[model samples]
Target: MSENNSSQDSRSRIARRVFPDGVDPDPRFTLANERTFLSWIRTALAFIGGGIAVEAFTSEIFGSGLRATLSIVLMVIGFILAAGAAVRWHRIESAMRRKTSLPLPLIIPIVSLASALGAGLLVLVFAGLL
Candidate 1:
């Protein structure tokens, strides 16, 4: 192959593939979407770590089955969120790259649950239950 032809082939490989007769979109938008997904994954990881920390540290202080169960439940939920995040991020990224609308994740339910749990914890702490 000629030098110019080989260089063109390399460039094509480096660039994102575009589907014929599909949406005309900028590659930068796809990249930005992917970055956003990664950020969400990081946030999920932080949530998981925080939950684990709370469970591990407070278990001894609470000295009660209820406290321990609550802490473990938080940690388990965090782990579930982290796993869901990875799957959701992948789906969103894939859809964005394909020039399709991203689907909504289950974050709404998770967030609501977390908020309720947080309120319960606060109530318990204030009442000297934990």
Candidate 2:
């Protein structure tokens, strides 16, 4: 086999190993999974944008050190969310393929709590309390 074909075969083998039962899930469910993944990616991008906006627009208000720290925190959270989304997508897809119960979504609460904290910090900054 050509190198590319060999690579594809290896990947297929790995996927088959991961889902030994190898049942094809409903197309609608697969599509929904993909949509959810895309939404998470969009959310991650938004977080990154927010970080950039904070650094760009709030340096004077927050001071360079605090602004950069907040920006980094936002960006890191975005990165974590993006990675978690991929893992969640894989787990859900595998569970569906295996006719098993879906995995619990743990990222939602983390994101919610982080968002609340970030919002509170922003309020403090804007109110000159930080």
Candidate 3:
């Protein structure tokens, strides 16, 4: 009985967070929110994995400083993406529950700029101009 009560309480808390106006949203919308969150998580994992692989396997190709810098940058981007995803997930869920427009995703611009810079750095490194 206690376990069931606790679980119910937990769910109620989540519902309140997601639906502050006490209106339950459609189940399909909630599932879509979950899918978006999972996609972001996969993206974050890929960024982190790419960083680790570059650092571990490309030591011979890049100078120590360049390799380390690229590795750190990729890891930092991954962390940022992960944190941003969580915030976006919550905001989207809340907006969906409230029947409001979804918030614009901020990750696209950030990732694009970062990728451009990373590519530039890689070119410089490879051309021995770094």
Candidate 4:
């Protein structure tokens, strides 16, 4: 019926290869989702920037080997965060289109655990225990 046609129209408007079903979501909701997506991108950039700053400014505090490892770890986390944000955005958008309950954000706990471990590593390094 008309609903099916509306779904088809929505699916065809953007990347047809992605989310091939479901009606168009409210524009306000979609814009809000996009803003959240941008926020995650900013967070990812902060992680990457922090890694660069540590590598560039901590030479006096950390040996080259330790600095390199820490820098790489932070940058890798940033990359993972950016990728996860993209996937999460798509998942949320898909759910919205389908009128389904959104999925729980799995990134929060994982990022929290990672950040705690990183902070612990920093503490150990600063205490000359690492």
| lDDT tens per residue, model 2, 5-65 | 5555534767656655546789999999999999999999898898899899986678898
Clashes of each: 0, 0, 0, 0
Off by over 4 Å in 4: 1-14
The worst-scoring run of ten residues by lDDT in candidate 4 lies at 8-17
- Candidate 2: minimum summed lDDT over ten consecutive residues — where? 1-10
The estimated TM-scores of all candidates read: 0.62, 0.84, 0.82, 0.87
The runs of at least 3 residues in candidate 1 whose Cα sits more than 4 Å from the true structure, single-residue gaps closed, are 1-25, 59-61
How would you order the candidates by TM-score, starting with the best? 4, 2, 3, 1
Error of 3 at 84 (Å): 0.5
Ranking by lDDT: 2, 4, 3, 1
Candidate 3 weakest lDDT stretch, 10 residues? 15-24
Q: What lDDT tens digits, residue by residue, belong to model 1 across residues 59-98? A: 6556667666666676676677767766776666567656
**Pairs of colliding residues, candidate 4:** none
Give the best candidate by lDDT: 2
Q: Using alpha carbons, what is the TM-score of model 4?
A: 0.87
Q: Which ten residues in a row have the lowest lDDT in candidate 1?
A: 14-23
Error of 2 at 47 (Å): 0.6
Clashing pairs in 1: none
